[model samples]
Target: MDGLMPPPARPRPAFTDEELRTLVRPDRVHRSLYTDPGIFDLEMERLFGRAWIFVGHASQVPNPHDYITTRIGREPVIMTRDAKGAIHVLSNRCAHRGVSVCATDSGNTRHFKCPYHGWTYRSDGTLASLPQRRSYPHDRAEIESWMSLARAARVDEYRGFVFASLTEEGPDLETYLNGIRHSIDDLVDRAPDGEVAFVGGCSRYIIRANWKLQIDNGVDLHHATYTHVSTLDDDGRQFSRHGGGPRIMVDGKKSIDWEPFGVVGFPYGHGYQGRPPVETLPSGPVYEEYVRRLEARHGVDRTRQILNYDRFNSVIWPSMTFQAFGQHIRVVRPISVDRTEINVFPVALKGAPEAYNTGAIRSLAATHSAASMIQTDDIEVFERAQAGLQSGAHDWVLFAGHPGSEEPWHEGGWRGQGTSEFVSRIQYAENWISFLCGGNGNERG
Candidate 1:
């Protein structure tokens, strides 16, 4: 009888709103936030459900009837451009039998035909037809209405980047992106044509860690000195074909002074790190030609300002993080409490020299690809942290370094020294808590 019995299912802990608030402390967060399935479920519903999550870029679906499959939280959705040249985010599930209609990652398709039932829907989510029309004894109008795919409540775009919210209520796209819009502008302005494209496709890898780990590392300037030390060469420079990344060591031994550069946090869990204290831009004929194209469009002074490269990874919280200089955008897709999928898409600056864009695409292979030395190092740390968090040895994860040192920054943000963990602190204390509590976070901590 004992051998025939199934193992008992583990009970999931549910927390009240007040209890959720207590999980996020001033300088640390409860370890359960990283390891609990119940907390992850609540986050998927309350936080990601109402937030304006990035779907994809307009450049990805440039033509009519083109679609790309992506996710908003745990729900699978399709980002499609209809024949009328309008974009829509539709639930991937079929109205009948709850089957996923579209299975491919991306392609040009006029209709999404559910393979199992032979029910088809147009790119705009309108029901086209079904195989068993005679079998349906229901009302004609109700059948049509019920058969079509459901759409995101609201969809909007800013400078070609598309974002969708599952719930109709909440701030507009511009309001949600207020403090972080400049980073998008900074990326777009780098192109001579004032546009950027997702040309290099995507490099995706799964990490056995929580999605928040990727976000925490996005603006943390202190970890590179140790976490990725192996990637540094004899001169302490990170391996890059273009040359010039943050020099972590003086003579491959002592760490460089990080006081000059800084980290900054904005409202809604957004943040960026100031450019490394090294010359990071590429040079040579390709870069010179790229500069010439930019100068031709905006003149020398504006071109210099456009290429200033003031910041590094800019994170638009809970979903996306990108680099204007690195020419790539990283999307964080959470699978579960201890699993995440990261999609790295290399960006191509429009109207820039072909060689310049080629270099950017090639650079991604050595830095962000699944087997890249740098990214693998970070993944290892994330997995290790996840394993350690499961131990129940520690109750909290600290972000207390450089306390009270974040000064007032531009556009109602805060700036701190490069090593300051204030960025993560603000995320947990302000935006993360507010979102979990169902508020549009701009709370002062």
Candidate 2:
């Protein structure tokens, strides 16, 4: 039996051209995108289905027979290192009786034994053994081709991060990643040893808001000063009331002005916010050392550009978001129209001083953790936004901040200054195209 199912009929267009144009004003977005279950389902099929959604890292399954299970879109997938050292991504369902082959989050096993029955499979997803050999008259050859575990249509890895797509056709991983590849490069390049390991346990939390809201907020720098004020205040520093006034610094230097940070929006929904280093100690020493090492390998000016580069958050089109300095990676898993599960992982510099990873974990936990003062406030606000969207008072929200104002494209894409919602606008633009065109043609705006 073919496992592929026909694409479901398209739902009524969630927003018309005029309505979407109004919804995503230069500075705001429509409220319906957050509350509408119909739009959310379309997103899973169009955006999530085509995008290179992050699977677990290769280091998570370093040894042969080691497996890590994760979700891609709504499908449960198993990523494993086979005896040949090749990584395979396959559906977790058993071919024999449609039972799940593996149930644990992760583990090492020579073969997968289906819990419902005695059917077993090798680490490579091939049929290994069944309970009775002669139960069926026409057995081994016929069963072999039919019983292998179902595999993802395509699987690819970049810088140790694994990704799988449900569709067999589309842009390859690199093309699809577009300009966002720099984020991955920066992640490894910043490591003293030019490599990173997935270290520390994952920190996960459920947010009661649409997944896109979380993504938009990740690149929204305007909130740092206001929403995160309590966090900074807890450290005994006060933000300047005046825009340019002197303020207490985390590292005894000038505080970041927030306005200088720029936002870049890419072709797909991918984008990033540029941030100057918070006046701090460790950055100078660590960055200088990293640059010197990079200079030795790639020479001077190039090393300067790579090491001294500033980026606040690097967001992948649909799910993953990276903060290279903080060594933080967040995976957004949409559970429903208004519910999202976010998993945060810390990257360890393979051969660098332990203090680097420790400091990163500490800072990440302090800022983004469930107990974080800043994150808690942001969560409450997002939840309130969701609740408000349920009201019929407003048909749309607006994204028109700084209308007709967008920066020129530099290397990867166009950049927008801080306080601009260009990032949010670009995201909705992509959403409009993907859903309306079914991941094909351009969207009419």
Candidate 3:
């Protein structure tokens, strides 16, 4: 029995909300924010407790009582479609004794029966059955009120993507999205039917780094020239002379920087970087076919304009990032101070050519898959970052990419050259730090 149990763990002292404020400052953050377990626990309470988190798509659980289990911050929860076709997010633990109710990863069932006590719950998280009617003197109504599975504070869908927030209060999804909802719209707008679905399941991988590191990388175009050089696989010919500038593509022996390569770091810590179009995808037949369909819906000139705008990587802070041009989305889950998990889903555009979707899936496989050398290089750095930070060699990480050069974005937010730390500052320092430090979520500190 002694060998069956692990050693006792040390208790982490609680930090007052005011104390949490001191760890964050504009321009830099303490290394303990990434390396300390106590701070990690605080993040779960203050940050994850309040922010909306990305769950699986509705398509993933389309059937009655179909469900997938995932976490909100650190709480295990279930996202399921009930018999009535309504989606629900329910705590995975049993109400009776807090035992895990859903043991399997995903499946369809008429009802969830707790393995510990057989207290069953309906898909809507209503109590369905009790082992014995007379186990207690309390009426069934009283039992239901006390024992039904706990539900998420809110569940909402935008453009077929589902999200859940456990905290009862915050900005609604539309307001929280602000301008970045356009990113989701852009993905749906491309389809002739004006919809998208998650078709090619998902790839889940664990990384030994803080989730924020990956979030920072999602919009940091400055790193691509050096960190993802292997992905380009040229003599650096396609890279513009200036770092973070538009990327050039190799044509035979010559390289030319393509048009419309740009990035913008927006309010609510969201932003996008330009990537080649779905039209530029290498899957010959489908690319042309899908374009023809899009052209028919929107005129040729309009189709071309639509396809070229902000179609690359878009980061929705604290939860997920999307690559519309690539037709996949990445959702990050923080597991611990030094561990994170990411789920990548290849999206299928409704009413589009199968070839187009196939091409998107293939592209995702080549770049972000677990075996992808391009992403493997990134993982190496994420791990080394954790290791280095834990070594106590330095007290802070600096984000000084473009000093005193940030400009107001034409619409809103800030615009900087692709190399700037605008995204990092906005996400970690300005927007998210303000949330963690108790400034208004809707305003800058």
What C-alpha lDDT values do all the predictions have? 0.86, 0.72, 0.74
Clashing residue pair totals per candidate (backbone < 3 A): 0, 11, 1
lDDT at position 327, candidate 3: 79
Best by TM-score: 1
Error of 3 at 127 (Å): 0.6
Question: What is the RMSD of candidate 2?
Answer: 4.7
Error of 3 at 369 (Å): 1.1
Candidate 3 TM-score over all chains jointly: 0.88
Leading candidate by lDDT = 1
Per-residue lDDT for 77-98 in model 1, tens only? 9999999999989988888887
Over 1-445, each residue of candidate 3 has an lDDT whose tens digit, in order, gives 0010111222543566577667766677788888888877766765676676788789889799999998888778889899899999888888889898898878998899999889999988888988876877897677777788888777888988888876667788777777778788888787867888888878877889998888878876556555665555343332221123234344333244222355677777888765632223333566778888988888898787757655468888788998776678999999999999999899998889987777677766656878875677788888888888886767888776676566777646666766677667777666666666544364465
Q: Is candidate 1 or candidate 2 better by lDDT?
A: 1
Find the 10 residues in a row with the least total lDDT in model 1. Answer: 1-10
- Which runs of model 1 end up more than 4 angstroms from their true locations? 1-13, 134-141
Tell me the lDDT of candidate 2: 0.72
Candidate 3 ranges with C-alpha deviation above 4 Å? 1-13, 235-261, 276-283, 309-311, 438-440
